[model samples]
Target: MQDCRILITRPEPENTLTCERLNTHGWSAVPLPMMEIFPLKDTNKKAVIRAQIFDIDTFDYVIFVSKNAARLACDWLDECWPMLPANVHWIGIGQGTTQTLLNEGVPALSNPGHTTETLLDWLKPARMRDQKILIIRGEGGRPELGNKLEERGAKVSYLSLYERKKPQYSAQTFFMLPDINLIWITSGESLLNLSEYVSLHKPEWKVLPVLTPSIRVAQQAKKMGWINASCANGADDNSMIKATEFHIGKQND
Candidate 1:
């Protein structure tokens, strides 16, 4: 064992899953979740989501952006839809989202890649014209998907199911773990939050190797002037581990 510590900054539940997989591979996982997810508490938004649930069959398409979105949205949908409305195309952005939706009884398909841009690439402007699409996501998520659909003549509505906030951590939080030599982040938000936390504690960590889920995120890290940011191509356990091994071997060589 190299005795290296791999930082996992994915939000909870997924954070635990990723950590377990890392431990099995002989890398110590630092499970400091950078963001905490909470369902929307505003009365108006809640009412709006409830209304959408009641009229779920009216939409031509629905998209789940994250596993949390799938879980929260389906939890609300369960009361109204005993069976999913037929003819509505359900799409989840990532494999993680697809699997979570499948677990929560929402049948969702992921065409190929996992980002919003990838989905837009698969969608034809002709197919979107006059279609009604509902995008379920965290509060203040990226608007490109909905905006692009609307521009293509599809009527798009956003269902903000939850919000993500950075979790509070004490200095003692870092005491138990060894030096963090590697970090794995799946999103730009996670990178931002984790960097803030690391700067507060270990500013020198700016030079530590980082593993991003996609090339876009890796470029984001680079634009921020971080060193050694590598793309793992996915957020799944196998993909993360494979990329981690490659980086570690490369470092040793």
Candidate 2:
């Protein structure tokens, strides 16, 4: 772990936390955030999101797609709603998101895997028919979850609180790309952004090993010509550490 240099591709504060965690565990973690998160600045869109927060109690199921979503939604909820509805069931897509919801004083349930499919699977045994579900996420994210839920007889609504955009980086940052031992991408979008960066700056480094949180991301990496892409159990600190260990172990063998 000491010799391993991992490139973390998560957004700002989360990337810092992941780097610190990896460094504490004796690995060299580089902060190379591929995307940046920004609050919804458009007046009309902002008003819509706030309206959703005020009427959150109308939904039976409230789903948070990521830690950012949970945190941002909670901020609005705190300002608009004095108390969260007791009957609304909170569902977080992964452990990190679930923990964020819990920290915000919201009880939540999360699946073992970080993928949307896993969340769908976890909810399959429950009654979804005619239930109202509200999804809070960043702008322009996948509609698969909401669509699938709707197909299962649920009324789904979306509240987009933030926006995700590729970070603007200097050419010098790409110079260090070649020395990276492994690249850790948390989402498919990040993986695509990393691939674009590599293709434009250092095409040869595209062959470097990559660790992702879901099979969808791993598949995206492979489609982009990354030969050594593997998926971790989920998108959390422990899962990243475990994936890093597994990659290193395989290399040593």
Candidate 3:
């Protein structure tokens, strides 16, 4: 693991932190962000997003899909809402999102598990009849979460605060691609974008070892023809680091 050069494909800011952590642990982590997160600039949409944050207390439950969602939504929440409503049940997809909420002075509930399916399972027994649910997330994410909640009789609404876009890679970065020993991908969209970029720029590197945070992401990589894809325990930095070390150990063995 110390000698391995890991390619991190998370979006910027987050990628910087992950790379720093990986470097602190002895791995040479190179950031090759596959996606970029940008807040919505449209005034109309921004107003709606702000209004949703301001009126979050009206909802019975508020769910955050990712740390980005939690952080970005909290920015507007902090501006509009002086105090958070105590009665609203705050649900986060995983520990990372939960911690982000806590850091923003918003306490939340989250399962140890990190997937949308897992969150749905945790909420299955709860009474959802006509309950108003607000989900804060980036634009154009999976609809399964909202769909499942609606099926359980919850009136689901989404507040898209940010959007994800593919990053523009430099020629120097492409030149260094062959040196990458492993790639860490956090989202299905990032994996897809990486695969597409490789297909166009460096197809032979498709055999590179790729680590994903969830089985669904691994499956998506496989479907994209990446045979070396594997799943980590969860999406957190520690989980990804441990999984990378385990994969490297197995390779050495």
Candidate 4:
């Protein structure tokens, strides 16, 4: 392996662990986070908390979009209500979020695909109709999941747990280095941020294959005229490694 370098564009814990996993699998992995998440200001989030305080038991299900959402929402839950309602079902978007719930001594419903569209697909036809669902998420996440829930006759309420913003451009991200073998994008927003950050630096380069988990991210990159972008079918560490191996082989030709 002639240093098949890959860059991971996910944030914080996800990026760090993803890089470690790639290294374990015999790839030179570099973490280049394009977005940073910060807990929402307490004062700003209090209103949303207050609104949901009374109707907490009215919700049939509580959904978590990310681990951060699950952690933050549970923290507040511990403070407001001594114990969770015994009958309320908990749903998580993926393995990561589901694990968070599991750690809290609950086995939550895990959606097959991590994306909102797939999550909605998994919830529809049977579970969503007449369900009172409360979505625990960050400020300004994709509205598709909530909108789909509403359209499917679910009474959906969103509980904002935190916020995320574009990370400041890292000077290290621009320094001339060997062309990357594969660039991994874990989030659609991070992919967009990576493009904007690269555009600001205006790195002189030809074309490099970019791998992302979502079609939406690939489309965004395509709009920027980045032709060598593709979506990975399986959204996991194994799938990312497989995609990287495939692209590296193509690049060698």
Candidate 5:
């Protein structure tokens, strides 16, 4: 027993899922969601719909950055182009997104690791050149992936599927201690959102040792004055659990 009770700062329902997993490991999970996600009001919804009706042969590849993006793209594609062309190359950022594509009966190649750099590294000089790639993602995501692909001479278009917003405060968050042992921040936005919340409300949960999934997010946490932050190698559930274990163990020692 590590006596490592963790607090997850992912927004809402996701915190419940993380808490459930921590419970299985006999650790307490404290939820203090840092942000909220809402659907972006697409001004070009009709255009998106119209484009979806086009032949799949028009595009060489479809890139999905997150499971949410994959699900939304798959749903939209299914509505317009009921039968997906077998020739289209589908790229998933990680196993979760890959699984989402697989469930939708789409053949997709997943990046070995769940980061923008990892995904670009996997494509490299061989696969990305001259490809017409459609990237389905959330609004305000890092443009590094698209910019890198463009640098390699690949034609890339971004399709914004959703928007992320700040979640309202819960009284539970007001009661949390300022220095929780570990703060689970799954996204850069969440880290920034938490900082914003602190700046506004001066909540009890202040600076914390953050557990993040990527180096960029860790950097963001540090920039926000979170002194201790550890980046998981990947975004998988096991990776988060193991990263948490290591940080908590280090603290105990």
Candidate 6:
């Protein structure tokens, strides 16, 4: 793994950190953000988001679906609330998301992938029949969380703070990709964007090793015709690094 060159496809800020982490762990990391995040700008969507923020106290729990959502939730709370509601719980599905909340001085119960099952297991003993939940996320996120909450009878609502768009990489940029040994993808959308690039250009790269943050996302990559996609235990830094190491070892073997 000493010569491992990994292609990081996460969005900015996070991708910068990921590159640093990978380098620290002895991997050569290349950052080429496949997707970019942008806040909702349509007046009608903005109004809907504002209305949700205004009614924040009404929900029993507010769950952030990503690091982007958590940060935006902080911003929205700042716009209207003098103080955070005392009774409402905050949830973030991954370590990155949870850490984002912590950075904002919000103690989230759980939402990072490794911790998500713990949150659901914790709910098993509670009465969700009458609970109210608000899931804050970017556009086109998976609906499984809300669907599961509803299955338990919790009234579920969603607030989308941003949209994830494929970045416009120049044709030259695609041609200049490193001799990457591994590709790291944390989200389905990231995988989708990368697949689009591979589909249009280096079709042979489909067989290159891919490391995904979760089994669900790995499955998605496979369904999309990725020839070799590996699953990490979770999206937390340790899990990703460990999975990357596994891919490295397996390749070297």
TM-score of 2: 0.96
Give lDDT for model 3. 0.87
lDDT of each: 0.84, 0.88, 0.87, 0.77, 0.76, 0.83
- lDDT (tens digit, per residue) of candidate 5 on 55-86: 44577888888877777778778877778887
The model with the greatest lDDT is 2
The estimated TM-scores of all candidates read 0.93, 0.96, 0.96, 0.86, 0.86, 0.91
Residue 69 lDDT (model 4): 81
Better of 2 and 3 by lDDT: 2
- Pairs of residues clashing in candidate 4: none
Write one digit per residue (lDDT tens) for candidate 6, span 7-56: 88889878999899889888899999988999999999989988989999
Task: Locate the minimum summed-lDDT window of 10 residues in model 6.
Answer: 110-119
Worst 10 residues of 5 by lDDT: 171-180
Model 4 segments beyond 4 Å from truth? Answer: 50-55, 78-83, 170-173, 176-178, 202-206, 249-253
Whose TM-score is greatest here?
A: 2
If candidate 5 were superposed on the true structure by all CA atoms, what would the RMSD be?
A: 2.7
Q: Give the per-residue lDDT digits (tens) of candidate 1, residues 64-158.
A: 98888888888898877788888888999878788888888777898587678888988863489999999989989999999999999999988
Give the Cα-based TM-score of candidate 1 against the true structure. Answer: 0.93
Per residue, candidate 4 scores C-alpha lDDT tens digits across 99-181 of: 87889765588878867778777866566788898888888988888888888889988888677888886666577645676
Candidate 6 Cα outliers beyond 4 Å, as residue runs: 111-122
Clashing pairs in 3: none
lDDT by residue (tens digit), candidate 2, 1-253: 4679998999978999999988989898889999999989899998898878888998999999999999888889889978878989999999999999999998998886788999999889989999999999999999999999999999999998899999987778787554888888899889888888888887877788888888888888888899988899688888889888887887788
